[model samples]
Target: MKSIIKKIFLLLPLVLAWTACNDYPIDEDGLLITTRSECYVSSFELLGTDQRSVIVDVATVDTVAQEIHAEVNFGTDLHALWPQFTLVTDAKLEPKVTGFVDFSDLDNPRQWTVVSGNRKVRKTYTVYLTVQEP
Candidate 1:
């Protein structure tokens, strides 16, 4: 009985360490593929305009460290386009905006602008990311 108890105690640490080192595979919804890389843009919104607040719906994949571009068009004709805008995320991250654009040079639509508010906006645009299982 003493030898059996000694053997069990000796094996306990190895068993626990093996279990801790084991990583299980995962399965989730909206998972594109099982790979070491993935990128996407989740949601985008337009805030603070002379007309009204608007949200743009987008669904697409993006590569890591690459810019997730978006084009916003406000259906209002302003004499001089001057509207402050920002992109807010549902995540705990702070709101970010690309440097405001000067659309005064191009006159074609009611309102058309790019997402160049200030700095390079980086956030998990895609919500509920499906990280592929290893």
Candidate 2:
């Protein structure tokens, strides 16, 4: 009986390890397991003054390698305008940036929130826009 008990204990670790991995995610809020969307900004562009003109991509304004950056003409209105965004990995933007956005203060960085398609995770990104004055 003692030998049988020792063998059971030796096999217990292997059994636990096999059951550790699950095909589904943890259910904390009663939600089923689903594929989590990856956070990525595929395309970022600005609208031109001409309605029919081609869209211009926003470029980096900072010295460091930042994800989002843009350069705009001086005296441009930062408010009442929205940037066109193309996302990947089945992601969505928070605060519904599809509408107008306010960036009146260039000193402050703009915060954009990206939410997973499954609505399970949220991540924030900073956008820096530099004004190019002639």
TM-score, one value per model? 0.25, 0.57
Stretch of 10 with least lDDT, candidate 2:
48-57
* Predicted structure 2, TM vs. truth: 0.57
Candidate 1: tens digits of C-alpha lDDT, residues 1-134: 99999999999999988885554322232212223322223333333345443223432324353233333344433233333323223112223334433333333322322222222333343221111223
lDDT of 2 by residue, 1-134 (tens): 99999999999998877776454454444444358766666667655434221223445432134257777766666765566767656667755656666766878877767666566776676777776667
Model 1, residue 25: what's the lDDT? Answer: 28
Misplaced by over 4 Å in model 1 are 24-54, 57-134
Q: Candidate 2, residue 82: CA error in Å?
A: 1.2
Estimate the overall C-alpha local distance difference test score of candidate 2.
0.62
